[model samples]
Target: MTKDGVDTSGSGQQSGKPALHSVYSVNNILHKVQILDGVKVTYSSWVKLFILYAKGYKVSYHIDGTKPPAGTDPAYAKLCEIDAHVLQWIYGSISDDLLIRILETDSTTYEAWCRLENQFLNNKEARAVALEHEFTYLSLSKYESLDDYCQKLKDITTQLNDIGSTVNDQRLVLQLVRRLPVDYDTVGAYM
Candidate 1:
């Protein structure tokens, strides 16, 4: 041990462990997380996954704009470095088209996050209308299996709810029952 009792390990960390606020690299984000293709992603799901991802790196504050270090703070530079990594993750996790739309030179991570949220959530009325129509017309026969159809319905309902169009359980059940094929009429009657 050194004279002051600090670990003298060659690893450069106090106890050969990363500091609590270490600048994390973007490479650590998992590959299974889908790229945010505006059309394909149901925004809320992507946001949840991305938040969990950033939190894993102890950088969730960048996503939510909380507890940011001021310029005078000792950790400010480190936060900026980590924010750059967070920004890279955001830029890399989106489609080329979405990247083109949302990219801004010298933009902070919080700015990009808010812009992305606005992109998905701004046109609530239009999205809600379209989703409502889709939910009304969806049929089990259109999908390869009943599971796919139900999942689609659930996704539609979730998107609608995200946009402030609340779809209650009863309404969802009604839609599910109403769209059954003619062959399931007997079963539908029982439902």
Candidate 2:
């Protein structure tokens, strides 16, 4: 038996080799990735983290749209089994609202992945405009702490850059200074 108490003695297969089912752990993934709530985390960042987990588990083919083996192929059953586990991971790591929006009947992991990507990324120009507006409206006076305000600004800029809007360092610095509270007049002047 391996760590999870599943027998891995390679019955009728290979000696001392763990079966595909025994190789992956569900808890390990959900712990590392925060639930993708769309507001708390950007879709691109969530996808990057999920890609890292899938790749590390050697199951990225399940979500990378790789064609599964034919039904008669020897490895077909194993692919189906592992893909089921991947589907579980996807379901477990999303918000209930998001789950309700994207859930489909009898979907393969690849289809689910595509659905999520399309939902979040299909309207890139619109998202960028909204994000730009958000960045413009962030005010240091609204946040009690200067650090919180700066971090929020940084996160929005990063999200904008990731979506290809390209917030240059000069503009970012200008925004940073422009949004400062009146109390930071000396500091803003130095910037």
Candidate 3:
């Protein structure tokens, strides 16, 4: 996982400090990492983990999606689209777990999930949940400092953890945040 001279931490930090929070973000990269049982992963279990994070944090959903009922109900459609993309990402990373979770969901929801899955199978970039414009707005250009980014990340992470989200790999997100070029200080991966 360590790239050439990538520092792993990607920056410097006080040694021997235990992590207070598991998830991290900078410019809303959405690494969706989770750390459990000492195993760290990024881009893995992203779908369910994202869903868990959203529900756990009470994050609002957007309506007006691309389908029937959802297409008609903008708010519900937006939520469905968001959920579907997240589910598709998670399914790609961990198909078995996603399938199991889908099987456990209501048949209607599962069917919706399949449609989302097909969309992803057809095109990867087409399902990108995080948009470039949105990312640019959140990044350092407007935010102005790493502190701002970390603070926002902390708020989001707090919400996700407090609500018992499904994230299974926290270290990945942490590492990605620390690697962010927003500042000179490098953050180490969780020990």
Candidate 4:
């Protein structure tokens, strides 16, 4: 062990060079992470965040749908083992209903990931409808500030874009102008 209590043995070091040590173990960190609820509409940002988390652990291959090549190399075998463990971790991070749906068609982690993505991320029509409804029903209350209202509008627009739908800037601006309360008439007139 080094001064920092990092084990340097078998770290492939030579010439008395300092051995590298991982500051955090991926499994340790991910074990505490919660799974995405299957019943709810999973957002793109949530999915992206999960992918980023998996990338931190160097297990993003499972999501990218890549398969290990058939080989006798021990390194490949070790990677396969790691992939399997990561796959299990991913499995543990999903709801039982969703798990069963994916398991019916996929035997590999990559496939399972793809299946989930397809099931959740590909429903552009439903997402677009929901975003449209949100946009249509959005109203600035008497208690809400103009800045806050505008931010909410922008957020909805962004969500629309993320789900393969878009509201043009002119339309958004027009909506903002139309939705302004009578108290903001002077500001509206100035625009």
Top candidate, metric lDDT: 2
What would the per-residue lDDT of candidate 3 be over residues 1-191, giving only the tens digit for each residue?
Answer: 14343334733223444332212222232444342110123222344565566454333131113343535675565555445544343344444543554443533334644543443333434322222223323444445676766554444333333333422346436533544663444443232
TM-score of 1: 0.81
lDDT of 1 by residue, 4-47 (tens): 64666743456445454444434554473588774457778788
Would you list the C-alpha lDDT of every candidate in the order shown? 0.81, 0.82, 0.40, 0.68
For model 2, the stretches where C-alpha displacement exceeds 4 angstroms are 1-23
Q: In model 3, what lDDT does residue 92 have?
A: 42
- Across 161-191, the per-residue lDDT of candidate 2 in tens digits comes to 7678989988988998998879899999999
TM-score of each: 0.81, 0.84, 0.22, 0.59
Error of 3 at 133 (Å): 54
Per model, state how many residue pairs clash.
Answer: 0, 0, 12, 0
Q: Which stretches of candidate 4 lie over 4 Å from their true place?
A: 1-24, 27-42, 53-56, 71-77, 88-107, 142-152, 189-191
lDDT value for candidate 3? 0.40
